[model samples]
Target: MAVSTASPTGSFGPPPPTTAGAIVVEGLRKRYGSDGPEAVKGIDFSVAQGEIFGLLGPNGAGKTTTIGVITTRVRPTGGRVLVDGLDVTQDQVAVKLRLAIVPQRPNLDRSLSALENLTFHAAYFGFSRKARRERALELLEQVGLAGREDDRVDQYSGGMAQRLIIARALIHRPQILILDEPTTGLDPQSRLFLWDTMRDLQSRGTTLILTTHDMAEADQLCDRIAIVDHGEVIALDTPRGLRKLLPSEQGVEVVVVAAGDAGTGTGDPLEAVRSTPGVERADVVAEAEGRTTVRAYGAVDAGDLVDRLKRAGLELVELRQLEGSLEDVFVHLTGRELR
Candidate 1:
């Protein structure tokens, strides 16, 4: 079966491909306990080949359950999953060969060296000793871990370990890579490094299915994102497309630069904002002692709001139209942000 998905721009491509990067899921449902509630309530979406598909959701959403079912770590009570047209349930053995999963946590054997870890992983897939060794070194170099190839896994930093995990997932060059919160605990530099690596992999025709709470990552990488919540698919679209769905009455925030007892926004800044042509409401934020922040939510232009503030005897330091991110979109759509 073919999966017809809308692009990030909310458009369609030529009809679904037959052999190329195609994934299909229909009425996908999975429940943990026989008598308990179902974790996944018949959700469905597909990943295109060479495309980065991001799975996003709040805590307790069925994101993990959906991944587990597709990867065959858990069985679906009723549904269909096909990777490259291979039925996940019927051909579990073969599907495993074509799929690689990067779990949310670092599961590397602490005692094993980087080289040893990849070597062991490769051998598990039946690679010859020499082949495993060569491939391990090659992948280490690819992920910029060549210098640390001999380092013990336990000593590897969060980012370094993530790279190794990604490289290990690619040792066999699976058609699809599933990443669950791959960069959760990493520093800024490490997160950026992983982003680069992901781009490189996509260039080589590797389909990527990833999950992350980081809005920037999803916006930068994912061709489309599936916003899951409470065991259901709430929204699925490109990051930009999702942003467009925000309420027409977008809000603008302004920081006050008033002088002489500016602590309580004593001046007329609030009046100036409310008087703006498009501004529906505005007020000073008392969260900070010296900071006077004004936030307005309505069909108002941020530029106009800024202009109004300047004319009202208030200096414009910085002004921005805040259209909350994917997290905000999730919260607006699902009534909660993904943890």
Candidate 2:
């Protein structure tokens, strides 16, 4: 379970002469202006056909700029990107035809009904009138907007508009779909619905490249993930593989209610756990509702840790063993929580 870390010179060299990947980026770099900062710096990764690849990073980590280059919206300051073997810079039109983008914000035609939106998008791809209508209806039904096809998109709820946007993106059936923070503003139920929709699209042979801050979403959907930070790829692996980057594969979450008295000798529960035997590392992951939740990693003896806390006058509210998580990996790599 060794996780691979990418270095600018070695691991991220040029891609192979020929690749079956749906999208390939090599030595990608971008800077805003003559004196401005570099946004993306020599990044490399590939997304296979029919694979759900995730790009994860905190804001300002250059993932957005990298995605901009991939979608052919931003001209790269260096390196090259290929979609289906066509250079994004040289084959803009051809590359665009094979890719569809679902932006984080809903950008459906506000003046048009949901059905008209889909039909118009398909028509732009040169579908026949009959084909446009049939395709629009099918997509509308598939996105659970069948009964609301005639309603103007501006009147739709956030989730509904998002669904319409997804339907519109699929109208032309592009070979690759780029979803930028697809479920960002969605409620839990709406988010789950979209997750299912994405899965369905994948089942139908669509390759998806997702950029999301939600570690759970990346863990659930991506076949592989590339974690970009400070304009470089820090780590790339499957969710499980990334978890292996932690000091230990096993961890324990302990929630303790602190005693109110000022004289309580528990200097810092987190530090205590760190000094405890068999514990490799410990972090205070959360503190709220008058409870402190500490996550300890390594060959931790949960019973021993709890007993030590009790000895120090800490009321143990909950204790649970945990599988190392993607969030842990992110923190381990960047030393910052994902925003």
C-alpha RMSD (angstroms) for model 1: 8.2
Return the number of clashes found in candidate 2.
0
Off by over 4 Å in 2: 1-19, 248-322, 337-339
lDDT of 2 by residue, 89-133 (tens): 998987887788889788888999999998888778877788778
lDDT of each: 0.78, 0.83
Can you give the TM-score per candidate against the true fold? 0.74, 0.75
lDDT score, candidate 1, position 181: 91
Candidate 1 has its poorest 10 consecutive residues by lDDT at 1-10
lDDT of 1 by residue, 127-228 (tens): 778877877897888778888888999998788888899888877777777889988998988888878777877786778898887878898899999988
